[model samples]
Target: MLSGFKLLACLLFSGQTPTENLPAQDFDEYQCSGNVEIDFPGLCALLDMKNIPAVCTKQPASLTTETEEEDTDDNKSLIDDSSIWPKPCLHAELESEDPLSAKNLKISGWRVDEQIVRVLQKMLLSLSKLQSLHFWQAGLTDQMLISLLNTISLCSNLRAVTLEGNPLPERSYHLLLSEDSILTHLSLRNNRIGNEGARLIGSALSTTRSANKNLLSLNLAFNCIGDEGAAHIAKGLRFNCALLFLSLSNNQIGDSGAGHLAATLAEFALTHEEVVERRKLLLERTQDSSLRVSSDQSSVGQLPSVPSSTSLSASKGENKAKKKEASKKEEKPAANKENPKSNKKSPDIKVPQSKGGKQGSKEKLTAQEDKPTTALNEQVEAVEIVNPLLDRLVQYRDGELILPGNTTLSSLNLEGNKITEKSLPLFLTSLEMQGEEGGLLRLCLQRNLFSPDCELYVKIKELMALRDALNKNTSEQTEEEEQGAQC
Candidate 1:
């Protein structure tokens, strides 16, 4: 029998060795369909990932985790190697588990590149005891996903993921989503994926709709997943009931996606309410219309005591007396309004309106008049949403400070104190703590703040480090200078 590791490799990469998963850039790297020969050594040489004798010191393929015995191991700094589980859903779940355990783990339902995916495949299979994972456009591919699936066919818990640029076929992604995932947060954004990819992922979500309810938040933005993709996701969400926060930004997922998602959320929220007013109205209109009893019955009134058989005669006698008294009083009212002789004459009385007529409607009309829209909700109509966060985070427009009117810079995080230089970059890096969306990572400082030193010195240094790391990982940076402060 093949070893578990080898079996996993065969399962994911169809028996391709790590040496065969290398990148050559012979054809376009974006295309997923091909049987191209890979030279792992050559690719590692081209990229600075190889740990070749004295020639290349950096380890190619992947980063290694330092693992120790479970309970007996007392190294406070060491973490489990996650190279053990390779399956997508299983891997994501396992990686998220022991949130404080794994160091570098990667798994999700998205388009993964080839070479980068091979490293992930191995990482998933070998580092069964891994800790955390941080992936931003690390060349994940289709065949490698198969390897990933094989590496981890079963898992219980997964931690978090940051996937931005890795691309995978839609069909494959949906298959991954089909698995039971325990991951709480997922970030998959900016990957040029379209509706087909979204449909696949949505299909997976629909399958694991019950178990994956553990997911608290999800970010799918800046991908080209338009209306159809968003529709599929909305339909999937109908089966999901536990999600709290969802971000679908810059996908060109226009009004249709917005409306569909909004409608779904509104419908779900209504269901959770104690008394779903709209649903009650709908139920009354559709299923209970024919059962309509007379509305004239006062919903609230003093209860009349039931008369026993012995008391029936007395009750009837009392009713007759009451009617006689009412008749006498009715006649006396007119007499008091007129002269003494004419006082005995009964006067013409106006008839009360029917419950189904204008008298009943007038009350409702008055209620409606009193129930005007709140000043807060309607007063915001003039406020245009021109991505205030963008205007705030990106202060330099043509080398000038262009603070849009009424923009609150989230990066500043100046809630209880005045902002200074040291506090800003701490706020910016805080965003990096919020991992990937499309495997295309863009740090959001609009939601954070950096100290002036951070804005000037610290952030520049950090940006340079970020750029070096990202540049080392992938050749996707075209305008890295704008990453740091310009103004």
Candidate 2:
């Protein structure tokens, strides 16, 4: 059993879509209290809500505070201050004629008691001034949602309502949302809304009644919006320009889904011809800049001024040398291609079938399941981007972008993004520009869900070799400088 555990253990230790796990010390310094180099590099688990490090959002005017009371019984109370939760910023009148009736809204989980009724009554009281309401995951069923929606419609102030994470089916939710003309910010994350729900949302977004003019942000991540849903959403996007940010992350929306959005953006640019013309102007300007630089480099040899400027320019020479060294290093990834060492990262296969399941019916995990692969072909449609900066490079978990640091490194592991042939040139160019010793020394691109023909593999191999050489050179230079200082 121990031996089997050893084999299957490696299965748990693999990279996801775009996060390449590397030793932490390579990028960050975490010296132990008493021990050095004890910690291996691992990512803090990056979920949707809190992956990017802290950025303070605006605090609501008031916060509900709860105090815990020592429970004499066996029950642990998780929702002590569930009441007094502020109303959703977007709200509407519930049942009261008083326009500013939103003074009492509960933020706690709904209990089927007098307290819950009091909270609902308070919310109902706020309907006159309420523009939106959100009750995400608080035991609100389909009937309850419909009832709330129906109740809110009576108030002219009710604009938006969010009942995300509840098991509200698509058809009923759509009709309700369509009726609310002033609703702009809708969150339906982690819901079972398929294509039907998306189109319904789309229909609501297209509305431009005198009462409801602009709808800005729509967050519908983690929905089951496959290609069909994306197309419906794309249609909504085509006609609507009032919306600014739309988050559709963590759905079944794939390359095709992205394409729909991209097409919509292109359509938007086309609709507003000024944007198209400006892009052309910018492209021309970039080409002109490159030409001027190339001309400047070429003209240097003919002038007497060249020697003084060129001779004293040790930093420029150093860059050229690094570029040359990096070019030489590029050969290594090609060699790795012939003998891809990364392919053999995990030979440790283990099988765990103990107390968790029926004894001895060990769950077998397949090598194919463990190793995901794709192949890019001539038929693969590549996205064309006008801005080189926005092009996808390496990314971390949850599609966060990863660029090589300002130095060289020894190991790299960038998973969570699909970087392929089209972006290959740009990626390499960026890596090259990063220099051989890209403050990041190691380049590890393993266990990513990229095409088998991912030229990035080759690019990483070359970058790694460059990183190794630069570190070697840097170490040597440091030693020489130290010796010179000693003398």
Candidate 3:
């Protein structure tokens, strides 16, 4: 038995069919971590190995020891070295034969030149199965990102993406908001996605019918999002429920913006919990229905056939055919009515041919008569200078509007904002609107303009430390460093 098994193993390993035993190969990860020059051809070969899923390569220079680094006292930068000694175009040899097998790719601190950028783009274009990607400190810029837009859209299975330290422009980063994208985790740390980008992303996230409904984490740290942008995001977040973790650190959020975010967090939680419960109920109902169908089948001693793709297609075709027939029936009366109208209009149009001069003069006279009425309407509109402030209950800024008793936000990060005593009352009122179940768990109010002895400060402290008799914690942490001087 042992000899027979050995023979079978040898036969399986052998290429009897003139094809490699790709299915038997189990190479899943490739890691290159050393100071030596990376053999790009060898790396590509390893990645092309059957079933290889992840590839990680740290820059060789970063791994060099101090002693090894001191030996080369040349002041030439990576850019300068690349320019001076250009590597041979190894595109043919370096390209992966089976790039689609790669699911995760992580390349850190790469000295990306024009040629290398092209190679990277080509590699990404080939990776149809790629899910997660990280380009940390890769010298990536706005132009580079813009170039990869089409390639990025092709990655239908992509869920998580990190572009840390890349100088991504608004146009480049806007690709993330594509309806085809099913991104669940997006990190744009240190990328200069300004207020406009933030607004765009927020709007996309708010679309519950979008593929982004599965999105759970979003990090926009170091972006230049301000009060207006924050408010826009807050409005969108009120409708979104799938998001669990959000990081908006080092943004230009002010009191108005902070209040808007806090309100959203306080109110959005309830809706999120409700959605979870609804999904659970739906699953239970589906399972019960399946069980009933199985039970009915067993009792009848006949298995009821499930609808196949062909049957479904045929049914759809029949429905379409019926709808077409019904449409044709409906169109007959409409066409008859339109025929009479067309006949009458044709006569009226033809009658003008005999009295063209008179018709032209009459039309000109009507146009002249309507000119004063149009001018009068414009004057009325100009005279009525509507006060925008009157339209709102709490007037803060131009575009930062927050609705109380209508959010489900639980965690809020409004640190380093321009919040003062004046904004505190409104903020507290909004929090109270959340009721017992909607209290904020985390509130960051550090480096804001607030007096120590002010009533707002005292109230804020009280709200942060709110507890129950059973020692059930409602709030977790409140970041309130007194770094700023009292106003």
RMSD of each: 22.0, 28.9, 19.9
lDDT tens per residue, model 3, 167-241: 654436656655556677877766666678777777776633332456666766556787888887776676554
- Please report, as a residue range, the 10-residue window in candidate 3 with the lowest summed lDDT: 388-397
Q: In model 2, how large is the Cα lDDT of residue 392?
A: 13
Q: Considering lDDT, which of the candidate structures 1 and 2 is the better prediction for this target? A: 2
Model 3: lDDT of residue 124: 59
Instruction: Write down the lDDT that model 2 would get.
Output: 0.39
RMSD of 2: 28.9
Per-candidate TM equals 0.35, 0.35, 0.46
lDDT of 3: 0.48
For model 2, the stretches where C-alpha displacement exceeds 4 angstroms are 1-108, 111-132, 156-160, 207-213, 268-487
- Greater TM-score among 1 and 3 belongs to 3
* CA error at residue 410 for candidate 2, angstroms: 39
What's the TM for model 3? 0.46
Which runs of model 1 end up more than 4 angstroms from their true locations?
1-102, 105-129, 152-157, 207-211, 268-487
